[model samples]
Target: MNCDQRAIRFNCLGSSMIGIIDLPERPLPRGVLVVAGQPDSRLGAQRQFAMLARALARRGFAVMRFDRRGVGDSEGCDYNDSDVRAAVQEFCQQVPGVREVVLLAPGSGSAIATASACARIDPRVRALLLLDPRRRANAARTAHMLAPPVPAPAPIGAALFWRRSQPPRRGPSSGARLAGLAEQLCAFPGQVLVVAATSAWAGPTPAQAEVRQLRALVERAGTSNRVQIIDDAAPAPADRAAGGRLDGDALRAATCASWMVSW
Candidate 1:
């Protein structure tokens, strides 16, 4: 039988955050809470988040997906320490028999999840599944470097040259941040799965570089076994050629589902 799912509204910092809870007929001892980053609601892009939640629920796991403070039907600005904490509390209270919680965070939400898990901020949080965890952009640093104290007078008829000034190049800071997060999570007493998706569209992608850097950091932390890389090489040739391209989202969902079931 299909699980019972209901829309929920949870109060956070005096505002409401919209969410949905999926409870299996016979629930597992663990529950999952999906935390998405900015610009993505609980549904996720192309409804991938909803699909993954339904899939997991069918596999006998209790699942909850919610919007952050301000996105979707939620109220208030998305700036507060109570985002993940409130959601976890609501999930635990609503789900009757879950003994532990697993946070499934994608994109920049991974950083939030890692910080919470490492700090043991919530005792119920037991594991993390981070997919394509985005590196935090150093906007202040970029702005500082790009905007010089004084601009030299543009040469006569050189307006185009001035317009083409590119922003300052980013250094290894993003990699360093990832390394720090991985180390913290490794020290925590819970399983952490760092998943990297290398391709997005049918062209050269930038996430590949990030994945390499993150993988190196995990290896340096002596936790390379904990990271899972889903790229061109992992899929079978037939799967890759099914539609003359690989479905990155499908691969990611399958990898996550398989790992969670085993965990």
Candidate 2:
């Protein structure tokens, strides 16, 4: 499906904000409203947001990306909760088919602030997409000024673990325990083989990137021992037979058993 892109303007507290809406031939009820950031505006760093909007629109989703105060054609030097509400209102009004919206904040620079502002967003905003939450840098200074306070942190994602002869536990451990375990592994008088899982699904996930980071950290920490990865996906091929789960499970078991027996 083809997407049509057009510029738009909206008023928030008497200031004009510029934006672009990516409309698909047949749009879905759920749309993406990109929360503009500083120094990049709605285009994003290297036009990432624009490309993202177009790509999403091609897949039948309606995407709206607005500019922050300082960037693009937007006026004034500040934006607030009013701007967000106005944008959401404009987004819904522009795309009548879209009843709900998901706010996408691209970087950690303002990830927390953006999410914080929407703590009590309009009912039409169904979700928040904050990319790179691992490296949060700033908090909206005026966040407290908003009527309802920002909700407590409700992070989503899997916890990383390190397995040993008698590992800490079978399931996810607390952050403190995880840190202590990492320190313990670095101090242990033996080799460490970090086993991180990869997906049969396409594209690079945070888990995979974290696996690489773990390997690098271990290499630096355990300077004397030989550290290696046991489940690195070297560009996994398509699941031809669609039995990726069966094959992956069998391979993981065999690899672990063989490694233990060899040791």
After superposition, the stretches of candidate 2 with alpha carbons farther than 4 Å from their true spots are 135-263
Quantify all predictions' global Cα lDDT against the true fold.
Answer: 0.71, 0.60
Best by lDDT: 1
Per model, how many backbone clashes are there? 0, 0
Taking every candidate in turn, the Cα RMSD to the unseen true structure, in Å, is 6.4, 19.0
Worst 10-residue lDDT window for candidate 1 reads 132-141
Error of 2 at 59 (Å): 0.5
Q: Per-residue lDDT tens digits of candidate 1, residues 1-263?
A: 37989899889889988999888899888888888776789998778788778877877889999998888889987645577888888898888788788888764544554546533777788777776555333333467677868877766556756667766666667667666665655665666776655544445667677667766766777765654444433554554536667555555556666776775
lDDT of 1: 0.71
- Once model 2 is optimally superposed onto the true structure by TM-score, how far is the C-alpha of residue 104 displaced, in angstroms? 0.6
In candidate 2, what are the lDDT values of residues 84-184, reduced to their tens digit? 77888999999999987767664343443454455444666655444432222212433456658768665444422222334553433334333443444
